[model samples]
Target: MSKTTIIDKEAARQIREGMKADCTKCFSLCCTALNIVASSDFSINKPAGTPCLNLQPNYSCQIHSQLRDKGFKGCTVFDCLGAGQVVSQVTFKGQSWRGNPEIGKKMFQVFPIMEQLHEMIAYVSEALSYEIPEDIADKLSIQLKKLQYLTELDADDLLALDLIMYRFSLNELLTIASNFVREKAISKLPGNRNIKDFDHARVDWIGKKLEGKDLRASDFRGAYLIASDMRNSDLREVNFIGADLRDVNLGGADLSTSMFLTQMQINSAKGNEMTRLPIYIQKPSHW
Candidate 1:
């Protein structure tokens, strides 16, 4: 692994906390800024810049509790990644689009940009929390600070920001962080699988029965694991970055040491009481 600045536990915790969504301070930006397509995930089609019909006067979703039950599963899965509060409070000084109709369009446009920046901060903060080498940790820490500074920018500054360059820089750092853990994982795998083409590394096991399988150190990044039966499987140290776990069966699955498994992903998945998880993540009330 490469050498980088090491961010201590306290600093990492602060970063993570800032990236959490505080909806009480937000103006229902997600419910307004983004468009929703009519599908299994959503009950109705909503155009961008318009509030959903269920949005209450106080910016609360009227059907929030029954989103999944009423065919708006996407709303349940959606997270603003702390963007909503930042834009509502910092950028606009607690102003709402309704109060200032002229800024409504611009606010909607900036919401998505802020969302991307905040998401990167979330990923970068998670990477920094790992026990990596000093040099790599240092680099991650530097990048984390940069993203944090970006989040504090004013609306005009944020709107003028070059997102493409920032993404390239952040992705490079994250890829390095990912590879550091992946290399360690691969080294621990048994010799039964082919070195050139490991089935665990590239298999499309979506909707497949992988119950009780030894999937240690496998790379499931960006793979479609939707509806896969993974009961009692050994997912120790597996890379779950970008993996889709929506409706995936995780009954009795061991994901206690899985990497990059976010709370959003876990909340969207179908897990039972027996499914083990990382100590830091809280189990969903519905599960």
Candidate 2:
């Protein structure tokens, strides 16, 4: 992978001080290269590799205020560990993906790798903040140095990098993520009749532990599913527009072919490979 020089002190301070990190330095690659689909959390549908219509010329989300109402719940869930601002300012020196459309895609492709590195930084920093692990200090130093290098590389070098190097550190951090922050908490809220594309007369959610539930083609318009556990529910062809699904555990829910649902909403919900979403609702390239 290409070496990166994006770990400047200003960027580092954001991670250290903001709890929330901005990767604006790398030219807002996430906003430009990524598509945000519509779902219960976000109301609009976005296509892959296409700049979101909701994204402003400044590369900020135009609907940041009403993200939840518009079906952008996923955006709310993501924490970049200060990657955006750093990538914008430190690595690429504030150049935006918009300036060079062809190179833009390449920059976008490099983003996930950098994001992974930063996530580790956040995880490690969190650990050090709680209590220093004296034995892990040496290991942590090595990773920090690697993290700094990973941010400065051009797209070509990043693509060429041997993932095994980053994987070594990542494997160690994954354990920490699992031990300290595995699904800290989740809640499932009820959807209102805000969006109705299915018949409410022929469905049932009462007492249904939806985790892994299979409801493909079932009508679920205006259902009161508050606190319902639908984590891995199979909801192909079911209607969920206007559904209130806050705090729902949908880690592995399958809503492939779900009716009247937008990509943004699907992206908003919590999911994984097990979480079946519409074909349009692309799964995260990362695990």
Q: Which candidate wins on TM-score?
A: 1
The 10-residue segment of model 2 with minimum total lDDT is: 180-189
The lDDT of each candidate is 0.80, 0.54
lDDT of 2 at 157: 79
- Please provide TM-scores, in order, for all candidate models, with all chains considered together: 0.88, 0.52
Clashes of each: 9, 58
Whose lDDT is greatest here?
1
For candidate 1, the lDDT comes to 0.80
Residues 1-287 of candidate 1 have per-residue lDDT tens digits of: 23334577567856765666789999999999999899998989999999999999999999888887999888777777778999999888888998677788888988999998887787777777776767777877887778889878878899999999988887767766766765677677766543234335445777999899988767786788888998899987677877888888888999987777777788888888999997645577668
Mark the regions of model 1 whose C-alpha exceeds 4 Å error after superposition: 1-6, 186-203
RMSD of 2: 14.6
